[model samples]
Target: MSRGKHARRRANRNRATLEGEVAALTAQLVRERKRLDQARAGARRADTAQARLTAETAAAARVMAPVEAEATQTAAAVGPACTVLTEAARELARCDARLSRAAGRSADPARLRTALNTGVRAHLDSVHRSAPLEYHHAAFRRRRGVDTPLCRTLNVGGWIPPEIAGTDHDRIAAHMASRAGEHTRAALWCWAVPPWMGLPDGTDAPGRRTALGATTTGAPDLPDGEFGGRLRAGAVVGTPWRHRPLVALPEDAVDLAYWYRRSAWTQNWHPHTRPVPFWLGDEHAHGFPRSQPLPPGTDRRLPFPAVIVVFESGWQLPARHPDPPDTRAPTGLLYARGHGPTTPPLEQPLYRLAPGTRRDELATPLELVDRYGATVEGLIFTADPDGHPTDEFAWCLAIHHPWGLPLGRITIPASRRATHWTTAIDNTLAGVCLAHFHPTATSTGSPGADPSSANAEPHARDDADVHVLDIAATSPTTGSHRTPAHAAGRAAHLRRATWRYQPVGPGRQHRRWTWVRATIVGGRASSRSTVYRLTDT
Candidate 1:
């Protein structure tokens, strides 16, 4: 009970005191932390309010700026005219507003007229003019109208201003008619089919040309003119409407007429040069036998994606005559060469369509051929494979390979012949072809490719591989004044427009191949999609 017991009691009391102090301090710290959190939340609210107010202030300033600027301008314009009469002051204000609008938004008439004149000049340069005067004296005289009595008498050629001629359809007709004689002018064109089987030996008979079955005929009345009979092999048939004739050499009588229509139609519309015959090389025409042997020394390996053009002959009236007219424009067979396989053209859907069943319901040229039984024909006007950059045909041909698979043949029924294809349709074809030929070429997934795939590449545009070639345009008809020059100028005005991509995939494949549809319009594409894959039945 001594000094040790007293020391233990004192130590316990000290420990209890220390515990009370620690509890008090912990409570105070909790209160302080709560206060800090509340303050921070309030600060966040204030910041949000400040940001909203700043946005509102900026919006108000923007709204006021235009009014303030107009007021300042009005004040400046009213200087020194403060005492002017009310009417005069009002007039000044109107004039100032007009000046602002003209400077900012309105088109200048002078600039527009200058642009039009430039286009006309460019057009005239492209047109084929009569041969330059043979002699210097003749050239001088011709310039003065000494040699152009017809031009002077008819008041055509350069005599009539283009403004008047272009506006007045009748005057344009007269101007064109005056340049060419009635005898030379084509009344109606004929597509004389060559007898590919007439050879003594059947060695060269590429089974009946599958593509040549498209006999385009119109039900309309025949134009009033002599339908020229079969001409000699060397004789030229188709002379353009006005310009000098560009002759096409044919190997046989039927070939002569076919070239005649080709030359005539091309010259009348294009009038720039001869149609370059593009041959499908051996690789492209592998399974399809040769109707006639390739031209001597002609390379069989070159890739010419151009298809044969089948034009509707005015002489053959399918509606009137059950069988194609045999007397004048004989029903000719067109053979399309195939690259991959040799299939029976007659067994294809195009040839197997129910008799008298026309494809009026199908929308695309390809659909008409593959689904509804149509035949393929090449383009009427052959474009130079290595022609000018802006040449519509050349551009189409050059880009076709990259954009899509070869349009082996084009299809159209005798009943549903069209002038041209729409821009959307043409773009769709490009997309379909691109999807088939260069499936991975586009940034956008190829048609029918899985969209959600992690490995799928990005797409640059929604249109996939389609690109705008030119605006839709029509070629000049028999008496129309439209020149190749005008077509070229119009093409320049075309702005790019996007066509949405439509997926054409394995579902759209066909067994037999077809060609690209050819139309009379200048820039519009009316091509059929050729079957890329053939399924064994």
Candidate 2:
């Protein structure tokens, strides 16, 4: 019994030892799992820190980029201004040195002031003498030998009543006064000698007025017993008034007349002055015939020529008379018809002059032929040849001359009989003549006088460059009138002929890419195409 009890005690002791070991191993496993969890959390924290740093760096970079760009731009702008200022300062210093050197030889201040004053006075006097005057009546009357009827009637004392003298003249005078007021206010008055009224020597004043009776007194005096005797015998009881004197209108009156007439007349009635019609709505068709088709394949590059056209003025006479007295002839009808009492009925007259005849002394109803001879190759006389509404004459001289060249001469007849037939000249002649006189530089040689040598070289080089480009492609992109090939050639020529460059690298090294910007002397580059090349240098 004592032996069994001892064995049980031993077994119990072994069980206790095994239980202690199991408890220690479980504690170690728990510590290891806690350390692993802590390690994972620490790794996550490290990753978050790194990502935040990256984001902050990117944000800082974004903030600094535009500032850097602005700084660069500021530097670029300041560079040119600084250069200009430097140049100006140098020029100012040079000028100061020159002034110092010239101080000893300088003119007296008083003398210089006096000379300047004298020059100013002379210039002022010249300007005053050449100034155009508002009232040029004296000039016109002197050249024309008498005051124009319109001018005479406008004068304060010119209007006369028939009761004061023996004639039914008030109606005519009133009519003339009305016409003059309606048309003469804006008329540019000037002097012109009428063909019929030969200007007397030393009588160049345009405002002079003389009584007809007094003027005729120097001629053979009428017999006092003839028409005067009949008046004295009571055949005509009242005293008679002499005929009114006539004068010529100015040459520029033709243009004024055209402007006024065209405005007053409608298109149908005055087709010649109407805006030209074009089927294609092209501006080049101006002054040309509506019926004429444009040349095929013609683009805006080629401009059409001005053509001669005609249109009509609507004017008609009364169809019937009011009474027997009206049938006898209305008082002042002669003046209205632009004829004298003794003149024949008014009719459109035509006369052809001999070829090459000088028109220096031609009268009314006269036409000069071949004034320019064979030089008048494109002589087109467009007018209302068939009495249509388009009743105007368009005479295009075949010869092309410069702006100042006199194209033709027209004479104004002084006689009242031919007053109705006044000539009208086109004002557009000024613009058209300017175009012909200034042809494209391509067709003509260098325009204007040759420039100074210093100024000429740059311009010549530029023109040469433009001439070498391929006109179509380069012209559009470069905004140049020249072709690309031409531009390239010009750039090469200029680089070889005029400018020099220095290498920026060692051992005669040239840059792989070199850009050249060209500008005209004393002028800015007109186009971006003026940049010659981005090339290997």
Best by lDDT: 1
Error of 2 at 238 (Å): 42
lDDT of each: 0.30, 0.27
TM-scores, each model vs. reference: 0.18, 0.17
RMSD of each: 29.9, 33.5
Q: How do the residues 1-537 of candidate 1 rate in per-residue lDDT, one tens digit apiece?
A: 768788878887888888888888888889999999999999999999999899968755755677789889989899757756776768767755554444454658675455445432212332235655455446556577665333222222222222554558665554343311122321121111111111111112111111222222211122343333222223222221111122211121123223333323322333333232222211122112111222233222111222232121111101111222342211211221122122222123222232333223212222212322322222332323552111132111100111122222221221111223222222322222221121122224356655435575432222122111111211111343233554664442322222222333488553311222222233543222122111211
Q: Which stretches of candidate 2 lie over 4 Å from their true place?
A: 1-168, 175-293, 296-478, 483-537
Residue-level lDDT of model 2, residues 1-537, one tens digit each, is 889998988888888887888788888889888898898899899999999999868755654567779889989999999999999889777755544443336667665456545432212232244556523555657677876445211211111211333344554334223321122211111001111211222222111101000111111111212110011111110110111112211221222222222222211122232221111111111211211222233221101221221111111111111223434222221222232212211111001122232222231111111111101111111223332222222221111112112122211112112222111122112112111111112212245533323566432321101011121221112343333444553332212111123354588776221112232332233322111111111
TM-score of 1: 0.18
Per-residue lDDT of 378 in model 2: 15
Off by over 4 Å in 1: 1-186, 189-257, 260-267, 285-386, 389-391, 394-537
